[model samples]
Target: MSLFTRLATSYFFYFAILGLISPYLSVFLDGKGFTSVELGEIFAILTATKIVAPSLWAILADKTGQKLLIIRLGALLALLSFIVLFWLNSYWPISFCLALFSLFWTAILPQLEVFTLTSVRHSSKIYARIRLWGSLGFIVLAVVAGQVMEYYAPGNLLNSEANLFTNAFVWMGTVILLCLLISTMVIKPQRIVNKPQQQALAITGKLLDLRFIIFFMAGVLLQISFGPYYGFFALFLRDLAYPGVAVGLLISLGVVAEILIFIFASSFFKAFTLKAILIVSLAATALRWFIVALYAESIWLLALTQLIHAASFALFHSASMIFISEHFTRCQQSRGQAVYLGGVYGVGGAIGAYIAGVLWLDGLGASTTFLTASVSAFIAALLMLFWPKTIKKPSQ
Candidate 1:
């Protein structure tokens, strides 16, 4: 296979599994009769591992120059851990399995990101093209899984022998993650020159830089704003009395727009500063969440709102990739990706999930929850305005 095909295959499967989980995890947990608080806590546990896993692995990758080794090992171990979910139905077992699985699972991506950007020589546009396939994977799995559940309507989401939906989801996720692992094995390893322990420590000054600090805070808030939508959007749709297929379609619609943005990411990057894109993305996301809170009952309006995801997620992500790339040196690449994803996404996502759980209130507080997300995003946008007009470029 060509290089793009090989890399794309991994991205496809990685996010295919994500699609199956993201929109539906709450719905699945609800079917198991878990309360909203429990769901929040579960999501938090699932996300909390992210706080440490990626950075730990990235440090090792930076120190050992074993990006591919870490990636492959992570994928293999993650798949193995997730399989234990099939045998456990209780809250603790399921929660523990998810947490352990995420610890490994979350490590794979930051390293792969380093590997990918290196492959394409840090061209954000080319990188965005490859990343969009992951989005496509998400859309495919989301729609298919939703339709499957709609047809079969499994009474239980887990630990049920005859549950077609549960069985199919687990088996398919296993196969996809397996495919991801196999894809990793085939790729040529990244040959990063091993950095000393102090090399890893060298990033501390950069991490504490004022611009980076503000940028990190804004990114964290933006990620935190995703909690309600990520944790409860599917269930929220159901609460609005929408069918399963519609729920998936609405979610997928956002990514369709994201795919388009990725296709034209270079143009946007050319047209705007990274800071501008970040601010606009955050601002637009606030509006998107507000719409979800106020006008979600209308399918047309909801579809329109989903389009904002192109700006909210895709544009911002592409810009952030370039921003982070510019902020660090060549030697700092792997650790940079890890710290941002692990620290920003990890910390922000855990808080978001927990808060979403508490505010969701079993479908009674959906609007309030989403409204809170809007305010978070809006504040994130306002914060990004203070980003230094001059960014520090990667050391040659």
Candidate 2:
């Protein structure tokens, strides 16, 4: 494969599995008789492993100068760990399986980011173009998986062949196998590895910079607010009487919006400062969650909210990726991505998943949870008003 195809393939299947789990995991768990709190706890367990795993794997990759090897290992192990979920019927076993899956899964993305940016020499247009294929992957699976689940949903667990094909765990494991197959073919970028021994103080200084600190905090808040949506959005839709296919379409609508933003992301980066893009995205996140809280039962209103995902996720992520690339020097790239991913996504996701669980109250507190999400995102936007001047627009 060409470099673009290789990176695109890596991202595509990585998030294809993500597309499966993110919108539908709770629905799958609910089908098995888990409570809202338990759902939250399971999601929390899944995210909590991300907290330390990425950083550790990054250290090894940096020290050994073997990032692609680590990516392959993580993919293979993650697939193996996830397959165990098929046999486990109870809560703890399921949680443990998810935790193991996540631990290895965390190792793939941070390292992949370092590899891609180095290979492309940090071109925003190319990176966004490649990354959007992942969104395409996500949209494809989100719709197909939803349709499959709707058509062949589990009943009489062991008796029916239809349920066997429709089962969430089965779908997730199959996607991971695809990822593992693709991992073998991608060309490893030439020598993007960090020599951490000499750069510890430099990395520490970058991490301690007030701009990166505030930036990281803003990201954490955004992810924390995502807890309700990520943990329970499909289940929430189910409560409002939307069928499986409609639920899939609604989720795909958000990714469709995300893809459009990515396609035009370079123009936005050139025209505006990173701070402006981030603040707008955060504000949109606030608006999106509020609309969901107030009008989830209204299909048109819900579709409007999904459209806002362009600003909320795609724009914000494009800006943040540029920020990280510029903020850290090349030597700091590996750990820098690890720290950002671990602290922002890892820790933030855990808190959000757990809190969403607590707030759900078996779906009775759904509005309250979304309202809380809006407030959190609004606050995150407020923090970016003071982003350092050094954080300027990207070059391309």
List candidate 1 segments past 4 Å from native. 154-163, 191-201, 392-396
Taking all chains together, each candidate's TM-score versus the true structure is 0.95, 0.95
For all candidates, the clash counts are 0, 0
Encode model 2's per-residue lDDT on 291-395: one tens digit a residue: 999999899999999999999999999888899999987777778888999998889899999999999999999999999999999999999888887535576
Error of 2 at 77 (Å): 0.4
Task: Predict model 1's lDDT versus the native.
Answer: 0.85
lDDT of 1 by residue, 1-396 (tens): 777877887888888888988888887777667899999999999998988888899878888788888989999999999788677778998899889989999888888887888888888777888999999999998998788767656533444544566666777778888888998888876555555744645788889998889889998999899999889998888778788889889899999999999899988777777888889999999999999999999999999989999999999988888877877787788888988998888999999999999999998999999999999999999999998875533221
Q: Cα miss at 199, model 1 (Å)?
A: 3.0
- Output the worst ten-in-a-row residue range by lDDT, candidate 2: 156-165
Distance (Å) between predicted and true CA of 8, model 2? Answer: 0.8
